[model samples]
Target chain A: MTQTRLVEVRQNVLKHNDVLARELRIRFQKAGVFVASFVSSPGSGKTAFLEKTLTKLRSQYRITALVGDLATANDAARLARAEVPVKQIVTGTICHLEAQMVSDSLQDWDLNELDCLFIENVGNLVCPSSYDLGEALRVVLMSTTEGEDKPLKYPTIFNTADVAVITKMDLAEAVEFDLKAAHASIQAVRPAMQVFEVSSKTGEGMDKWLEFLQAKFVDGQV
Target chain B: MHELSIALSIVEMGIEESNKRGGAKVDAVHLKLGRLSGVVKDALLFSWEIACQGTTLESSRLEITEIPVVVHCENCKTDRTIAEINNFLCPVCNAPTPEVMQGRELEVTALEIIE
Candidate 1:
């Protein structure tokens, strides 16, 4: 019997996921189904916010959503109210959604039938930052009550996001939210990160957010 | 938190790569982790052993080397290591550089197997 010898291998640690993500990216591009994923801490109104946005956009475009949670189908139920197709991904114990999870979840759906897909990832700012889910856009949410230093504390998530959504802005005054400092915190980590302040409850700033989405999904460019 | 999933993928990839290389048993999977990869090296190391437990790569070792965050100072034209974790200021000239030349990488670069 020969003893196994150690070989020096210098490869990217995430090559496997990156390769799968690349394939998914190509697939999404070919089918013209733009995928936007949402990542944020728990209680950040991801489901409610998505519900409002999907309701507005469903008529104009073929939209669908896949929401991941640690246990319940609550988010799927909430988003389904928009009248667009919705699926729930129960991660069991996983904190975040990975590319494999997204790929596996989409196997039953007909990509060609959908114009855009939104994935509401499991609520966690840290775990989701490292995983690439083949999304065209990644929107990270931060509610007013969550604290202004959120961007500074969780720089990884902010750095990874394409846009930052400051949710529940309607409560900004009530909670004495410092909007300027919050924006500055985001800019500190991601200098040019696009920011949108909205209140799903009041429908405030939803129009502009919807318009931004339309520009990307409908017009297909900046 | 997501390290277990990442570790699982690494194990799966190692098995496949080993099988392709004449069914060699994987010994260890080497990884180069960049500073800005946003992955906790300790967490990954802890989860890797567990992730490999029932897989073909059960006995494989995960070797990780931390890579420093290197940025190209356009003004100074020198590749400088970032002193602070997220701040990308050039040490030599203190000029603000927007480009991220290195760090922020998470990829499986290689797999080691015994034939």
Candidate 2:
């Protein structure tokens, strides 16, 4: 009888991505650039939020953004209206932005000149959580129009995220969003998770969110 | 869309691993799949064949060993495997557990190959 051998190969499935992400994190840290990435479901207003954030924060510090999409440069164009440096990373068909893609996209760009960089991932909640883009903070956005049980339905994304953002609060009244229920759901997944409720349209809650971001600066952080 | 990308990584890993065996061919890839891991078993399995098309893992079996989600209860001072995916509370004292002790595995544990 022919015998087959079993080989032990204890390797991570996403090992390559993790290694690249760690390298990126180190590079960003050395340059003193606070990097933040946004992940959300489609039509959750990630672009609008970034647009508002860049506009408000631009005067205080140098900021640039990289927006990812499957096929269009629409988000990149929309964000560039803030008059800050903005680039579009057309993923073609990929649902998430991997660390390698971010690294490649930043080629020839000076990270040390910028105080902060933002990466708006392709609007996908599920796959993006699995791929870390070496951001200092990861923001998971959910719109008021969606059900409060969004966190429960996609616990992985909620669990992986560093912060939760309740977007489009200006429409909360019209949508009848249950704020209490939404908070409870988020807490159920990750207790005491930092949350920000904001409306890009009305500019509500932008100050507090910006304050949290500012606190993450190099001098303020350990 | 990312399932396809993840599938490509798996195939790439499988081929590289198979090459290390000195002409041995891999028949199965043993994986440790955790409940907290974001990858879906069905979706990965569906994309496996397509990703391995004409590659070394074309006919290989993806044997996934599912690991249960475990949490550390602060009150109970115990690490327990959670039965339900959404149950983030301790079964005994009903205290909320934010620390995940296990179940985020995404490793390729072993491979069954023939020389």
Best by DockQ: 2
Each model's TM-score?
0.86, 0.96
Kindly give the stretch of ten consecutive residues in candidate 1 chain A with the minimal lDDT sum.
Answer: A2-11
Task: Go through the candidates in order and give each one's C-alpha lDDT.
Answer: 0.84, 0.87
TM-score of 1: 0.86
Worst 10 residues of 2 chain B by lDDT: B17-26
Instruction: Point out the worst 10-residue segment of candidate 2 chain A by lDDT.
Output: A213-222
Give the DockQ of candidate 1. 0.45
lDDT of 2 by residue, A82-194 (tens): 99999999988788888989999999789889889999999988888888788988999999998788998988888888899999999999999999999989988876689
Q: Give me the candidate number with maximum lDDT.
A: 2
- Tell me the interface RMSD of model 1, in angstroms: 3.1
> Candidate 1 residues A116-196, lDDT tens each?
999999999898888888899999999998888898888778878899999999889889999998987887666667899
Chain B vs. true chain B: TM-score per candidate: 0.89, 0.92
